[model samples]
Target: MTQLSSNKASGCTGAISPVLIGAVAAALLVAALLFSASSPGRPSSAARSAKAADSEAAKRYHKDIKPILEEFCFDCHADDVKKGNLSLNEFKDDADLIAQKDRWLAVMKNVRAGVMPPPGKSRPTEAQQRQLADWVKYGAFGIDSRNPDPGRVTIHRLNRLEYRNTIAQILGVDYNTDDEFPPDGAGLGLDNIADVLTTSPLILEKYLKAAEISLDGALPSEKGREFSVQGSAFKGNNNATGDRLSFNGAPEVVFAYRNKNPGSFRVQMEIEVMAAATGTNETSTSPAASGIATNICHFVVGVQSGVAPLAVLLERDFTAEPKKHQFVFDRVWSIEPHVFKINVTAPGIRPAGRGGGGGGRGAAPPVGPQLRITNLRITAQPTAEVRRFFAKDAPPAAAKELQDYIRQGVAAFGLRAYRRPLDEPTLNRLAGEIEQRYGETGLFNDSVKPSLAKVLCSPRFLFRVTQTVPAKSGEPWSLIDEYSLASRLSYFLWSSMPDDELLNLAGKGELRKNLDGQIKRMLNHKFAARMIENFSGQWLQTRNVMKWTIVEPEVLKREGKTAGKPMLTDEIRQAMKDETTMYFARIVQEDRSLLEIIASDYTYLNEGLAGYYGIPGVQGKEMQLVKLPDDSPRGGVMTHGSVLIVTSGANRTSAVKRGVFVLD
Candidate 1:
């Protein structure tokens, strides 16, 4: 498992000194004034002819630049690693740079070319450029570096989608119930990373409820059916009837009986299983045939009276009719019963019989059915005691039985990207809280309801909790209290709680000092899957894609689209999801520039999606990464089906929303 971490730089190795910022700022101001004086926005004939002379004049020192340099340069070119090493630490006036005239000219040159500080960096305007030309004429000055005031901010808990994806990845279970929890509040223009996203009592209740729902299991339906076994004894022992029976849909059992079984009886059972189909297959628009193996039922003989049932016999090695190639489980049984009602008990199987007159001497059930009940012959052996017998597996608890559920909450809703392992005490306390909520409130199914509500609601989970209370006298103090810091750093960057490795680092007192290594390790973690899910889903509005339901055929035709044509099926939705996931995955793995998300030459699409976009030759349900045509405006999240649909309003796309999404 890979660790997740923040992208922030650490240790400040070789970082630009603070003094350089001031020097650069001064250089920019002077250069801006010089450029303005030399060039006009609309050039005149005389101005163009004097360009070379103006340029030479701009390069001169002391005679034309001393005053300009004194006003701007002396404050920042002091000796200091304070802001990118402008080094004004020793000087107080313009003469300092004047003594190093060549250095001042070099600064003047870079500033005039508009390349010194770089765009988005501290740079000079046209007016400042003209001043720089004048400063070179007067000579340059050194200045001290000044630090800016720090910005104030709040930390936030992980959002709902992130929390959901994180838990699903951790537990390998796709339980997306986070939507039922209370909505997260936005901070810093994003619900995901805001420190202001705190939890409330209602959220705690939701968490507990979600936890219970995630862990709880329930018994199969209680409804039962009855059938009969029939055969003609036309041959010797073991050669009478070729009975074949099977069961399907949910795990269950079967029963068999013969009228002349006054003594001993024997029966057989066989089974075959097929792979289960997923949600996508059920909603496929294309029609193609697929076959599945018929599961044979395992019969358990039981004596039934009123609503109670007692085991009557157990089966051994028995083969179903037809061939062995189509067979799976083959077991046979021999039993002798006295004063016990014999019945076949395969809950998930349906047998074919003739009369439906019940299994009696002259009564017969249906026949030639997909399920059979032959191999019937009674013996004259003496009846055994009604004490006990055997059957298949035991019964599970019904609705009336007691149950406890445990829900693993989502990852993105907490400090996910950090490395922190919750202690046993924490888990136990959480479990206790879970138990209390269920037992006290009588709402076991909604355990996650309370689990989410409580954890997300708590200040302990939401706040970074950086305030350190000193240990009492004679008590041992922790080394740096890195656990709190670890928690803060992870939530700040990754927008989720730390995992075991991170927590372990904090425990070992390594995270705070070794932030660089920890951050690197955390970025490679599997839970980083949560990062893609949360960041991309919410930011890209991929969650809103499913709401685009199909309307009437007339409406479709009016929109210049097909009505009878299958628009978005379950398969297509899943394909779109795969596209979203793949795109997000690339962002994390490649550490790609975020700007690529606004406009890229390539996108993920399937045949259905390709058709929707009027692209040709794409066929089938599988999703593929395709290169978008240069002519198409469809690129990145703005053009993605999910994102576009999500940002759209009723009956039309809203430019305002799309614009805000792009800007945000």
Candidate 2:
């Protein structure tokens, strides 16, 4: 780990400063002015002389350049042999070649760099290469910069992370439904790329389901939710049998419950465990020590979504006589959909099956060495927030009538859902759905539920229509609408829907005013923390660092390392990730140069990361900015443990992957 973190700078570092941005903008303005000044359409004296020069260059193209091309360059680029997708013969003359300025520029750059002749076949002399580059500049294909024809903007949809983040903000709850949604397609090394985001029927279904849970959590039900174990839909067991459901040894017994609202839950169940006798008193028929084991057995009780690890609410170890035990976790906070799990593991003894009446079965369940889960009940408990927010006394949004309440509720919800102002038609359409549902059900939640699902499933919510726009007529560029700009800013910076401030500015069509100030403010916002994680995660592929098996205990064993210090512990790996993300967060919050990301004299570190990098003085788990040792060679992302871990091979560090990580 020290070696990984002590290497010199590698991957991306600090961003370009505002001053550099201003300088680049100024240079672009100058170039654009020059292009305008040398306009070929003008009938001025300058335009006439430029046209004369073009005529002379076209004449020289056949005589002077043709022989040069045939001598040293045409082997690969000639007719019927277009290596590098370049065929100089395709261009009729300088005018023809200059029409495709991008290709011409690429050809000129390669020739100028002297990488075109490719070091093998009869190479051109240094002077000839110089002459050829000059000819490209002032002779046949006189170089000119040009912007290519604009293409249609790709439509973007909120990726899974963005959707989860937006739902959390919009609904005030941490909702994780990523497993429900299909994986978002990535493009240009980013999952948020618009070109790859596409809507499908499956994703629409997931969106509707997500919206229902979000709305249900936002407007919680007072009655709460309950699930009983009898006839419950359980998996990983013998079968879906009722209270008789029991499994022996290593088999699991999972009872699932789809928690509708955000709240706490209570799990009450009776587990009957039975194991074969395996002690000094095994042969003894005495009740005191029939089959007490020396080794201890343990089990876990926790709530879960999918395969999340168990959290202990209550734990105890007992001897053989205590086969049946009651477990009641008074309250476990559960916001999203999850299942109550009771995992029991009894080691060092095989599960004893039904015995002959000779010795009689152990004082356990009918099946020996097994766990019988009976009378299981998982009930959701309403938190104080839920109790106050959805009190029956108050009407939705303070509207007196149910209809007006539904309309206001839908409108307010629409603003957050759409992340922009709703048109009259959209408002009517959404409100109409709720009103129609309310008419039939006569319940506020029932009306809101289906209508909210409708809103979430709509294309307006699924895809970003604000992004697609045509350039203004007769102009090469057009200003993005403020709403579109807001979407871009929020999604790129915050990875979520626009906040109230951005939406307010967009609504007023004034986001473009003092745009630089807004960018700075956004960079300083707390949401910018997500940008540190999301952007740097995608850029450096640091997300892969969490797959901690890259350099595990097994790696050391497999590599025949007899004895060594562990390079990474779980805490160290976690600290390594913190170091990478915190470093980027500092860059954003401190307004540091982007190049600093490539190399920096200081980095964020806690005690674990500091010792891992051989730096002293850092204390505690809380990370803080630490000045790097002068000769430490620990200056950039390339040396970070997260980066090195991702780039490492099974049993050793991958020099090839490390090099590619730096170059790529």
Candidate 3:
């Protein structure tokens, strides 16, 4: 990570640069001279000439522009017609036309893109179209070149997904902000656009509550404690069935624990091993005359802290036997929470069935050895340093150390929250708040939690605030600061705050220079997959599939369902949605051509969707990539069940809707 100097040079600084001041003075002088020349009493010769020129231009508008619009546009944009709510006939003069510049701009954009004047309609000649283009470009109501306004962007608040992901990255704690916040409104097929992302009193209240919840989950508890978490609570085993646990390699079981206080912690596992079943029936009176040896189950139990990747604290193999076993793991470290995993291997042994039912009388069954975890317990005892830091009765000697620790923690957290280095005043204020809280609460964790929550709720954390740089004289646009650029890129690609590498490059002012490399790196990052769900979900309108109803008469009859409501099960709808999203992800990840979005030779499918599409060979609940035959009509997102269902009406397909979607 390269470090860059902080960007303090912004347009908002109090003192204006000499060049800008001069340019402003010149503009004022010109404006005053024009006003004086156009004063009411007596018009100068120059003013008369300008008036004559304007009249000639008005004549040209009526002759060239008005005639063309009447022929090619008025049929749709006239007063009685007003297609798209636009009445070109209302603009009688230049002022009226200029006032609605944005509408005219849209017209110009469409004309240039060749999307207007729908196919099969009488089209305007090239010469007539160019005349209209010139009228908008160089006529009296023309846009100003010197002050070309690109429009303003509304200040953006992080949406629910962004908030959750950003908090996870910054605090190393996963939070579900979606459950706490109201759904965000979308615009232009995008929910991230600032204009539609509104805030209300309820949203503000939710933010406060969410902040508190996030802080509580991230921060450690105030004191050392002991607790027991069921081993089945880990990843794999199902306690409801009470079936014997079995794994070929690493057991999916993982215990996640947060160490609030740095100290010596103990983890104990109470596991019961079942002997390998050698015969088909447990009630069999005798074994085969050959006397084959029974299979032995081996397992390696280990504890690995989250802070140290792949660092195992305890790892040993034990033979499976019919008895209870206890193992204790001890680790002394000052770090965040950790996950402990167990690995088991038993060759030539089949896994136990979900239920304890034995096989039918005639056949031999393949059963394997298994381990049953009865209990898992953990306890933490604070070290001397931790004890002193949170001591109820503080001594004078440890006061400085505790304060220093608090200051460091505050600074570090503030830097991450703000996504940049904080100014002295800001850092001091945050540190002071923590100190005050500490004075009130004597315990370190209790003191820091509230301050941390306050920081999380701050606008700096909630919004991506960019410093606006003022454009100098003759400059067409202002350049965004490096930190701002970094945030935009990260949120666009990863839907989260910039990681350390990105932030470091921004600090060194080299982010833009190395943008291509960064982009390539980010594309390969795990979070880049978010683009498929966030962007494609909206772009292809696949999210609407959840609300779509499969009401085709034949289809409804086949499925035995009523009309006017969603007949497809949630699983089928989800599978349909996944097909499009995964297709998009594959295109982006594999760097496929953009045209593949319209027509691809392959698609993703699961058993449910495959059966619906009449595609054979796919036979599982999980989705997999499959090749489409040349004659298949289901090659692109346009034909996918997700898109087809959503674009249709409750009872039948709407040709108009499908056509408009294709055009869009």
Candidate 4:
């Protein structure tokens, strides 16, 4: 009898009752007895009968199985040939073959499925095949049944894209990790694959830098600068009368302001609009269509930055008299430059004959209203109250308040970073670290920076670590926790951390139930387009087109004859890559059948690519969807210039390479 008390165990220090111990011991004894009975030999008569049957099967392997393999499989899988990296010639006995259990299992599956000998190859007799199956089934050379092996996945670090997007979502600030960190390794045609995304000392250093940069954007340390530019400085199309700027239909004047500081800013525009010449017959119209006689100039104001998309800020009608308009933009988080645009259109026009003929006798046609911009100013100033939260020196009363703020901030950030709530211990540890750092460095940002950097470098934030749960009775694998499932779904689709909605759903334990709906929502999001660029770029090998060079001497010689006409230019290459990326994005966005990737009636094209493919109608740098003719050969990705050029050699096309790509 075995003692099963937890206290007696080497590592277990807990106490167990004698009754529980006795129950456990009885279960262990029953399991052992069952295992013994199932073995080749035992005292029971059933065990003896099974041993005799195995012995007979063993004899068949030596006499029948070995002969069949040698006659049929040895030709391709022998030691000398070793086709498909397989060698059966080395197995002198069943024990030797059984040692390589996985290989033999595959052999059994292939042979039994009638795919091993291959088409047109001589096959073994039905009796011989049965003997081989019996040999494997009866445990060749005393080996037990093979167990299924589900491969393990290694811990994956957040790639550059994931890091940037995750930080943006967490902090409400944009930080480009790709610019600061080294490029991640691409294995299995994806940078996000678990086995390939490894951590290193250099990567940790980069993470520290990235954390500091992100924190700085979130909490600025200095006052922002103010600058202004003149609207006359902007380049615009010259009208017939070039005295003033004229916007016929579209706004041509663009004021590009490079914002060096990250804080609040105000933009002011001062302009004088020329009065419109009313016709003799023109009368009062609807209130919306008509405004104050002298004040009727309508202009649309918008702002755009590299970090975010363009946003229209204001649209209103201004007086023709000189006036100043001020617009206030708050919290301006992007470090990238911004473009403030003012789109002004001429006043409503009167019909040629219905309104009144051209001015008077010989007078020229009444000139359309023109806009003259006298001043355009931008002033950036930090919010003093908000800045106090990140101030280094704290007042007596606010010190404790600041400490609480730091704790809450770190906890909130950790929840997003880890994609789950932090435990009490972890929260306390981080808060303590921030307090200690604050004591060492008086600056609030300085203290928070190091603590946040540590969190960013920590394994919990860096890697997607899935907790292992014990499998329930009769189950082969354990199910991942709700939080883990949320993270997996988000990272798989968006290449970023789960949003607050996803986290909330996971907390409520409803993520799995609503997973399909959540996936559709995520696919519809604008960020999901990253999948098209990052995934398809690698899987289709279109990204490599930029790196391809014409190395063939003959190709170079032919290119020398056409000095100005290069076979492949950077513009043409980019257009080709964009074509494939846009096509893939459309397929996902429209939920079209994936088979369209191989054969579709339409593709995206720009002027450069359209010219390259000899297709007419495309006339601009912007890419647009174009329908292909029935006889056109450029419908799918395989026919795209980027794919064709990358797969082809410098001088000529490789039929074998194209064939292999199609087959793959």
Candidate 5:
């Protein structure tokens, strides 16, 4: 049996027990009996009976099934003419069909679906169709239970998107892996295809970095909490006077820092200094100090409440560097209200006698010397809310308590990260790493980051692994344990690790029973959107929308002719991608027919895409379902802007490419 022992199995609640073990001798005895009964001319009379039944089926296939195929299907599917690359000529008997199961299986699908025997052709009667399908289904050379095959899993690393999503789900950190990791190669345009997602030394390094970054983002700081706020709060600096001001994006963000608790604040500004010095100041880096260090542009960092100006750190005047570089302005200030205003001026320090710029009038933006803040990190003592978050995160001081904390924390985290419960050895090794790191520093939370990094970088977390068990009498292909099933279901549906519900079900071995409901629930989940994004993004080549230069239709590359449609911008390109993914998402979420993807009377559209497609009445930026008119050309994904543009050349459509996309 492949089942883990009850004592050895590990998960949140219970372990994955795929099959129970039996005595080897008893299993072999049963196998021998079963084998003898299935084989012809054995000592058992059951063997003769089985052989006779097989002969009877073959006789029926030749006498009944062969004529049926010849009369209806042979015109296009026999001898040299192989329609759909399938020929009845090759499968003269059940033996041929059994040897090449996939060929017959494909035919069976079409035949059962009433898809074969093309339109306006002589089709088989209901009885004949049933006979053909049933014979293929049951009467033919059927499954040899003794020699079952469930196929081998390629066991590849998650692609960049999956890695990102997995990190988000497991660590609560929305880590972006695309920027750091190399683009995963695609197999048949599908990025998640196992064999194509090969790991390399560079990828390992990327994983290592990703682990640390993910942990940093997920974990709270010791005593204080730190987080990255957007520099966009003051991105558009028209006045060029304020030291700090508030505004809004990883995307667009408008953060309001309000601290009710009493504590000093450490605000680290990743600022880039642009020095425009005049030759007046005595302070110089070299002999001449660039001859302009006399009238140096020093930054005034201040805070304000209404018009009453308050200097939080007036003694510190930041001077310009020799070259433009990101300066880390990390300092703790005894400031109140968690609010502040910063004064940024050009050449303000005129030998220590100069005043602020413009004298009440707005300072000109084209002024010399500029300081741009790219990242703003605020660190403050943990509030009650934050303290509650890391109540258990902060380790105890006592030796025994610390060890228990480490064990429990590491096991729980590893289970989540690895997407399955850790075995005893693995659990101990992981907890020991954290304990060792903590022993050196005596800071439990600090040590957890490296432990998390180690877990994230581990091969078990990186790859989709499955344990194997020996086949049983009638259960030769029961290889996917409950935990593995949970992982597979989660990755396919959510593009991440299994959530608690799934894990709970898996732990209790009830996941298989609730699979249909779980599938339905998951398809409607927000995470399922990732499936639409990643799968359709690659397959339809919509992810390449940004790279493709979409010009106005019918407008030539020549500079003079540019009057066909509105200017195609990046927004429109993004909308094009959104269209296909949303369409695919609707198919699964709404439980609509998959055929709708080919030719339907509905699609998703926002005002932008609607305007682009000449469809009226869609009035918002939010993409929503829009039913199409009978004659609307924008019925299905095949006609989507993303697919069409991707399959077309610039200002031209490739019939061959379009055909290949449709056929393939």
Candidate 6:
């Protein structure tokens, strides 16, 4: 018999009762035995048994099910009226659910399929359910159970777009990604719920993929001792039986030399990676972010001389995965020319590809592996610098110093309220994380720096927190935390972090305490500009004009008549954005009527957009507020190229879409 005392053996409702399981097992065994014995000889007994089972099922109200439902379902459905309806409290009798049989059926179906009451919810054991069913059949009554007490819920972090937008707002800079990240998993169809956003292995893979795709290819390159190296080996370790692999690469010693004179050298390389099924190990899901690819390798050119390696003249981590990887490092060395060594390292693992069927048993069979590299060449040296600047020294990592640096950044950018004043505990924890990663990974500075960037990019730092903290009474939540309040004010008004003035006010408890004064001061501050950029821009769909695609061939042909089909150019788009901002700024600063944006006589436009609108002789791309003539169809945001183009369909304008935009 299996002991049920260990915590692991316990059901989701906590401690399991051994007696319950024993009773359920015995009952099932006796019932099975009787059914087998009476088989063909007793049709009456079978009918009676079937009738009895139905009666038992009908008698089973939710109240009869112990501990499990109480721990899980009740938290959201019981007292919280704002959550989903259908409370388990009124389920005293089975007939009580007749009014909502559809809901009952849905619940039963979900329960049988193992989708609800959700994975993290309290799970009932099969034995427990059987025993409960039997007891209900025998006319059992509900026994009052102890209420469950799960720990307090923590806040969910921001999603990726929120992170990027917050950072861009904070820095007063543009940041975007060409690749869209996968949708985050949501509980109850809400990504903002505190408990829904989980940090899993799958989540880390998203981060890794995002880091690779978003990384800027701006590092400078160099040339020195150069050579073409090629080699290959089989998969697996230490001469153990494994799959055979054909591999080729430049010599590992190429990372030891430096370029003697300043000039440009173009080094070109290519690789090919292939996997062959040995017709054996067939049942394996393809590995993600792994296995047998030439692109996983790192290439380096060292500017070393006299074997004293004083400095690394040039270094860049480039991928050579099965395709051509090419780049030129101009004027890589500022010193005299010398023989330089070239080094290459390709790393990969072998496994089945993604979305494969399951395996039979035993160890999986190995697949044939192959990786190749060729077209190695050092073309010529550049006569001048390739990049505007380069920082060779190690960056600062101390917590206090970092805090100071952040403060300086805050001042330089003129932030309103920081989403939150990063507390000492948070800062210390982040610093510890940095030190730990540096020690464990020994990753190059470039890789290590992004870890800090990730920390800053996290939802905790980006989104304004709205957490409730209980007082020292160890009771129900009463007030929000200090950091929480800071975040709210920052994002709400400034759409960014709190500035020094606001931070000082927050420190003195004046910002939140004296609301009117802070609001007035913030209204006057430059941080208010973010409101025009983020909230107004989103509301106006200004950015969408850039990403929106118009595929209507007919419309394309029609528009292609003048200045290339009146496609919204960057110059034209900026004029529209400037027009909106200027109008909104006046609304806030000068207390002008907000309706003026839609009905004002004055409209802003640059030369490109002006000509596109048929208003001739407007020169230069600089935006200026110009008076709208009666002949001009342009006025307010309605006629702006940004709004008009985005609101249009592939072939023509969409009145419904325009109306919806206006309504929103």
lDDT string for model 1 (225-291, tens) is 1112343221212242223222222112333342221112222322222232211111111121112
Name the TM-score of candidate 3.
0.63
In model 1, which range of ten residues has the least summed lDDT? Answer: 217-226
lDDT of 6 at 27: 40
Candidate 5's clash total is 14
Off by over 4 Å in 1: 1-158, 162-176, 193-201, 211-464, 467-480, 488-496, 548-555, 560-562, 577-581, 584-588, 591-595, 617-620, 630-633
* The candidate that achieves the highest TM-score relative to the unseen native structure: 5
**TM-scores across all candidates?**
0.45, 0.58, 0.63, 0.62, 0.64, 0.41
Clashes, model 6? 37
Cα deviation at 15, candidate 4, in Å, is 54
lDDT ranking of the models: 3, 4, 2, 5, 6, 1
Task: Evaluate candidate 1 by giving its C-alpha RMSD to the native, one decimal.
Answer: 21.7
lDDT of each: 0.44, 0.62, 0.65, 0.64, 0.61, 0.46
lDDT of 4 by residue, 1-664 (tens): 0001111122111222344334334543453454334332232543464466556665666677778888999999987899889887686664455556677677888888899899899997788777677677665534443312223546667897888777666544556564567888988667888667766657755655555555544544433345666665655443222125433333345667765544445566666666553322232232233442333546776778765677887777665554444555453635555776666543553322334333333322223346666666766543342233333334234768766877677776777788888888978887887777666756555455555655665567777766534556654445677888889888888888988789999889899899899988998888788787878877888878887874545666675753455747878888888999999889877889988988899999988889878898888899999999888987778888878877888777888988887775
* lDDT score, candidate 6, position 165: 48
Instruction: Give the per-residue lDDT of model 2 (tens digit) for 141-212.
Output: 444434122234555677888887876666554556455667788887788887687655566545544655
Q: Which ten residues in a row have the lowest lDDT in candidate 5?
A: 1-10
Model 5 residue 218 CA deviation in Å: 3.0
lDDT top scorer: 3
Q: What is the RMSD of candidate 3?
A: 12.9
Give the 10-residue window scoring lowest on summed lDDT in candidate 6.
1-10
| lDDT of candidate 3 over 1-664, digit per residue (tens) | 0000112112111232344334334543453454335322322543464455456666777777778778878899988999998887786675555456577667766776677787778777888777767766656543446534334545567898898787766654455555456889888778899778776656665665555444433443445457786655666554321135554322346667755433455678888877664334321212222242234554656666654566655454445557888878765644355766665544332334423344333433323467777887877543322333233333233768766776676766676677777777867776787677667766655566666666676666766766545667655545677888888998999998888798889889899899999998998899998877889888998878887666566667656766555437788899999999999988887889989989988999998889878888888999999998878888878889888887888867789999999998
Residue 189 accuracy (lDDT) in model 5: 73
| lDDT winner, 4 or 6 | 4
